[model samples]
Target: MAEALANPELRPRLEAFDSYPDATPPPLAATEELTIPGPHGPVPVRIYWPGGTPSEPRQGLVWLHGGAFRFGDLDMQEADWTARNLADRAGAVVVSVDYRLAVEGVTYPIPLDDVVASMHWARQNTADLGISSISLGGASAGANLAAGAALRLRDEDDWKPEHLILVYPSMHVDLPEPSKSLQLALTEMLPAMRLPPEMFHSMRENYLGALISNPPAYAMPGLADLDGLPPTLVLNAEYDDLRASGEAFSASLAAAGVDVEQVLVRGVLHGFLNLSTSFEPVDDAVNRIAGRLRAAGQNP
Candidate 1:
């Protein structure tokens, strides 16, 4: 970890996250709140429609919020900003899903079920929302759910997203044995943030339920067969702990004949996308995602 701290490039990125500020006021008008039915119960969703006018049916995105599955909701400033930005920039109706968190239910299929249900609801109401196609994306564990939901949609419902965007996603359950660079980065940031490994393990256990010998491929989409999946864009932080898994997942998608693009931002860490006001990289990443969504299905 000392080596990671010594690297000038890594120190600044960690500092940026440590110093991130609250999000700015929303620039676009959001739709009235709505509740989508979930398997366990009703999951709240906030649909953001920029300018509140459906000139033409636009693309749609069902966005999940990040929290290691134990924290986060639709109301978080970052989540709200993401929804607004995606809607205005991508010209898509962005539905921010408030799936049940781990602390409340703490089990497998619970979070997954909520996301699937939300997508179904989104698809069913696409006409009202003026959306033509649907896409999935999220940050961190939210990204995990997004990937898993896409796989489920494909396998069970034959639903294919026009695109899949993951922002520093937690794609693998078990952290790869730390590489030299990873170890260095952790050493520098962990002490400052005081994030414990056991806490992360507990979060995993809470989301996965009982410790099964082998979790399903959908649980870890990086482990799943990526063939026939949608075109993907993965934005990763150069110094994030999850960088390796994100990279590996991109490789898997490419190997499966899926179109995949990756943007590795130097001097950044996980969850940076949420700090749009403070982090320039966050807005840059969001714009890039919106551009991709705008271009999806246009040429090919």
Candidate 2:
């Protein structure tokens, strides 16, 4: 498996994620870098305020970036670009969490604790931040943490997020079987672009450690009860393997009577949101996300 991942044949496809074109993020009214107290330690965060003076209180979002749990940071396009676009378009304040990665000795509950702490900070300071409501969301592994944090908040604090914006998340410990058409579509993808089942298995091992066999309740939220999670917007990449997990989780959310919107973004691969803002799908997804955040503030 390691050999396959290291194959020179896959280099170009792999490099695309790091080398993809990026444009300057739209200007925000202000961007602040701060640290909030966390269970593990202080968690760093970058906050992006909307560019305009708003007539009403804005929505607040705690956003996390994705790297299969161990590889992303606040500066990544998934974090910076996504936050900037959402703040600008949604007219909301976006707090991008620099949660601890699941690496070295860090594992379950550490990153989760960071996300939970960030949410608490955002919620407690909502008034000062000029936001009326708060939502929790992320992409891929970050999405997993967002969902886990939401469940933790629900059970431990009896608090509920205003909404969830999961972008191409991997929610299941075991990747669900893809539909026949999806399998065929995935076959056309480059080797490095596809997230094989083994990759998910390895990620689970790294993130969950010895508990992967019987992970805790919120570690893999797709397999947990979803009774009262907030209205969720799940965006799945049309050609990504994790689409199965996203689709299944959305179905479970609906089954549990939670409001859920599942959108399969067409003709895109995994981590599409991390690409340049010029990408049409990325633009469209940001618009949809901002629209949702705006609605949450207006109605809440």
Candidate 3:
């Protein structure tokens, strides 16, 4: 993925997809595009309020989109369709952050900073925004940011979240011990692995940028202090390279005495959440995500 990010030939293709994700996403009760003030500049954000009318103030979730930290934007299906569907299904307000990606000038902390800022914004304005409970959620790269932001909130700011939602997330800078020893044909082409090793390498470099050699724990929550984290739901894909890492993080969360729920969606690959049209399981996954998030919010 990193190589693709740097490949001049693939840049245009990536931009085109970012500009035109699933153009015909199902119409939702409500959608709004607005900007949130950020340290660098105004950050664009999309909001979805369940049922188009909050009958009453509802729970809030600050969402982040995944594109290996180098591709995608608000128009991407992960941010648009996912947010809309989750909002309505959970009957809560969903706010999707168009965080700055790790492009030429942007780097690690920048993307993670935007995520934390958005969370702060959502929490502070919940009342006026008709939001009651506040949860944090994301997919893939977005999920990494959500986790990173949560750790930052807890450690640096003495703040904490009530619920967390992660999907096929990359939680560690390094692969699990078991994955390190395994070798496959043509890179193995294992039953549950979709991406090539080179892709993961490139994507990781693209995300961290050239400056940072030793990425801090906040850059990868798997390395962070996990004690005191709130309840979390981890959704892992059956055939994703990061599945083991995500599950490991979930295990760590449980070990820390935090309530955690982990589930593996069978017969699905990473990025399935945005491929609902091609994969039937995606619909079921989204529904499960909505239910998990709603349950988290309704808890005291």
Best by lDDT: 2
RMSD of each: 3.2, 3.7, 6.3
Per-model lDDT: 0.79, 0.86, 0.77
- Candidate 1, residues 1-300, lDDT tens digits: the string is 565567786566655666644545545666658888888999899988776566667888889889988888887755887888777887777899988887865577788899999989988987788777888998989999999999999999987888998888877777655557656766656454443567667767778877434778887787799888888889887667677778778888889998899888755667776664457777788789899778755635
Candidate 1: the clashing residue pairs are: 1-184
lDDT of 3: 0.77
Model 1 accuracy (lDDT, Cα): 0.79
Each candidate structure's TM-score, on Cα atoms with residue i matched to residue i, is 0.88, 0.92, 0.84
Looking at model 1, residue 142 earns an lDDT score of 90
Off by over 4 Å in 3: 1-27, 52-55, 178-193, 210-212
Output the better candidate (2/3) by TM-score: 2
- lDDT by residue (15-93, candidate 3, tens digit) is 3323433456555677888898877788889888676554666778888889998988887778888887787678878
Better model by TM-score, 1 or 3?
1
Worst 10 residues of 2 by lDDT: 9-18
- The predicted structure with the larger TM-score, 1 or 2, is 2
- lDDT (10s digit) by residue, model 2, range 1-300: 455357675443344445554556687889999999998889999999888778888889999999999899988878888898888888889999999999888999789989999998998998989998999999999999999999999999999989998999988889888878788878767676677668779999999998999998789998899998989999998889999999889899999999899988876779988776566776788899988997895444
Q: Which stretches of candidate 1 lie over 4 Å from their true place?
A: 1-15, 18-24, 52-55, 177-190, 193-197, 297-299
